[model samples]
Target: MSWTENIPTWQLVLLSIVGYVYLCRVLRYRRLQQKHALYPYKNREDFAKMTNQHAYEIQKYLFGVEFPFTMQKALEFALFRTYGIPSISSLLVKTKQLSEKQFASKRYADTVVLISEFMAWSPEAERTNAAIARMNYLHSLYQKKNLISNDDMLYTLSLFATEPCRWVNRYEWRQMTEMETCAMGTFWKSIGDAMNISYTPLTSSSLGWRDGLEFYEELHRWSLQYEEKAMLPSLDNKKTADETTALLLYDVPTSFVPTGRAIVSALMDDRLRKAMMYHPPPSYIQTGVETALTLRKLALRYLALPRPHFLRHDIISEKADENGRYHRIEYESEPWYMESNTRNRWGPQAWFKWMGGKPIPGTEGGLYRPQGYLIHEVGPKSQEKMGLREFEEGREVLMKAGRGSCPFSIGK
Candidate 1:
């Protein structure tokens, strides 16, 4: 008898599934290997240093070598702001629509992204690890020379130094007064009493207790815990006054940056959050205004993915098809959504797309996936893999690897 005819039907089905998965793994490995080959070194730290050097060259090139300041500034501002979005070609088109005057030039416009596909690395992340590695080197050097104390060096190096940034035009930087940077916040709060607005510096991050929310608790803790000072080094030394000042003030640790203004716009304004929670998609990410939204500038979802395995106590039934086979169907679907959980709803392709290649919408601990007849923990790379800087990164780490490491590690 033929081997196929002799084998059990279930075994044949299993064999087919196994074969398909093995093919997928082989393809994925090849792509990953190619990416690895493109880089100069196997070490992540060294790669980051290379990235920083490239950024320096890119900076130098922009400084009047190839373009005037006006063109450069507009390009940088628009590009920097919209760098990480997937479908970057589409995103670019959309952004240009929003601010055509600034990003009209095709060269600078298209130059902004590293990956434009839904689940690919942005130009920024490609450069970030290198920048961070460079920061570590600089800190090591400073510690060796005793230029900065250990705590100062670590906080500065870990938090502020590696932050991705762009040079704003001098005119634009000057245009944003303290009032505007800090406006829209407290300004909106005291709109009914215009006279009292002056008492609160619209830009002051130290407030919010008066608003009865105390949402700035973390920011307050940060300010109290650390005070920054400038320590200029000699010419032979690499540290400089301008960098010191920038890190001390404007480039506060990524933790301190108020990253999710859109979330605030959604949550604090109960009306907006209500709309998002109860709504559908297509207008914005979750059916609101499509201004801008991202989960820490990483891959974004359309609706909240509702990860923590939304609990549902629902009715289940079987529907008879035209062929008379009963198909399992769920009715009166209660999505069982949760906002704060790690999962947020993007489209189907988002998970694998945003994170190199892993299961998207999985649990906080991770999803157990089947691969080539073996169980694999399919999810995002852990923070340990990347050494991420803040809360958002931590959340991602937990989602990807919290239960433990590889499934093949133990006595299986």
Candidate 2:
């Protein structure tokens, strides 16, 4: 009453409205949580069937819609693994000259491409095949570069399978169902098989499939032992590891790097935190973050509101482009192919000559027909540019068949 008497009428009204709205939200959140607790799935098959039916929506929500948060969680999960950290740090050290420049956006772009391609939705057969092909390509490229060991590759694959589910289940508005977990496990197993990775873990459940939770805990325990023996051996390597962590957070302002490190420490398990010699964030900061996240969860779950779809459909799109329309180049296309070529420069001339001088495949009827000099000189800019027609036609076919166009389809 005394505080109200001191305040202006408008100010008092605004404060009352805010307080009422917050109270309503808290009540609704409690009701929703109580409702959700009533009927859990009866069995694994029931969960799997439900998840399979909504696979597209689920994938789109996790990877396409909530990508920024999902990506942060994924990164945190990777850093938590002791062996995983060294493997990633070593790869970054070998690939980019980060010290020369603070950070390069292209490195991040390349990673986004890989993640989008793997998670993009299509027909089951098509999606699986595309993912397998991409995985194979990446594995071959890494092997050729001698960037990672066999053990490192297997460990990385396991993390990929387990971490997203763990992160989402822990922090998202709703917990992931057993079926959803199984679906991810199935998808990742297919990828691991395609990569020919050995040492796959077996789930204890008679569900005849790998369980994400079991695999994650098993790997976590094994990683701790592995790091103690192998990762912590050399003082010089430890210094390099610290440098690599800084390089990873290069996008963060210098003044905020310590805060970033502390947040990462807070997210990790006690064993990993101790192993990395990381101090937790100040209690106040940690509590603030937790409270904010809890409020977000309550709002998301109780309001029955749609999840935010902030991520661009085309991962390469600029932030200013709200519609998400952007030029997308396929991995096997001209400029992109050249970028991946480690040896000599692969220009338009070489590509055209390899294509038997024709603009499109199956066009020449196997004859030694050569296009004119003008066409050759015009190169990729020519209307009959290499890969142009095939890509367009394939996209049209996908569209006509009720499937969406490829995310990486080249623009006109």
Candidate 3:
């Protein structure tokens, strides 16, 4: 009170605002810590039994603690895989909607929501089912839009099933164990089955949970080779390249374009750089970045303290009750949830209304639907349906390409 009396009115007002902000943040952190403390499992073994904990942990570490690094990897993957697909890239280019809407932001928000739901210990069944249903609906929309070929779809799916596991294993503070690997394989397999892909690359008999570790390693190895030589139809086009580059460097200063490009080149492999026709960074710059990253990794491994309370809980879901019950209001209020609601034209309310509380058509009886949604209103599907033979052929190609490939082919 005495100190406040000595301060000017303007200073006092600014101090009050700062105090309020700090207090709010502290309260929020405490609330999150309290909420996560109620999580059913105290250790890895208990979490492993849930069959989705590995995916949850991966998402938690990526989004909550290491968002920037995760986003960097994710963007690199998208540039090489999703955007590289001719049909998908064409659709994006034709839309001319980058400035009006940022797809990366929306995709990140949606992923947070999906992963949070899939990982919820309370109402586990309901949340799991909802995540699956939402994924199936999205797959249907993609098919209806006729934006990607079946081969592209399978390739993309393979990347998802393998990439995160590989990234986390290599760069994350903690390496995933055998059980965690199995959980990841199981989780993706379930999603693949729900989406009704004609033939998933991984089979129980040969490449199932038992071979989860090897399967992920092999898939990751093959994907790296495939991505290196895989030609992107739009890569050479100036307009498309500029637009894609802008999307990648959104919010960055124009003056720093060279520096930004240098960083991007440093992050990507030679094959990816060549595929995108980007010039490699200077040797000094690359060496500097590598040195800094090595220091960062060492610091994180040996010096960094435990994550703070604010970074403990997922940023997508709200604090649950003591009984672990979550309410619709709580879900809608989450930062990621609210962001999605604001960005998407057809938000959760519209989705719920469209479904009318009925089970999604393709996910019935837990039977995989090879051909999604028989709706006649959507124009005929453009993508060819992938069959067992086609899936096998694609696997063979990957295997051949991965011959003599090392596990740590791409390093951070």
Per-model TM-score on C-alpha atoms = 0.21, 0.54, 0.55
Better of 1 and 2 by lDDT: 2
Where model 3 places Cα greater than 4 Å from the true spot, the runs are 1-81, 95-128, 144-146, 200-211, 225-233, 236-248, 308-310, 319-412
> Which candidate, 2 or 3, would have the higher lDDT against the true structure?
3
> Best-fitting candidate, measured by TM-score?
3
Prediction 2 TM-score vs. true: 0.54
Give one digit per residue, the lDDT tens place, for model 1 in 314-345. 11112223433221121111111111123333
What lDDT score belongs to each candidate, Candidate 1 first? 0.26, 0.45, 0.46
In terms of lDDT, the poorest run of 10 residues in model 3 is 403-412
Q: What lDDT tens digits, residue by residue, belong to model 3 across residues 293-383?
A: 6776655554454465465534333544454433222122112222223323255553552354422222334322212221111111232
The Cα error of candidate 1 at residue 253, in Å, is 44
Ranking by TM-score: 3, 2, 1
Residue range 263-352, candidate 2, lDDT tens digits: 655666655555555566788768877787778666655443343344233432222123222222222211221112212124554455
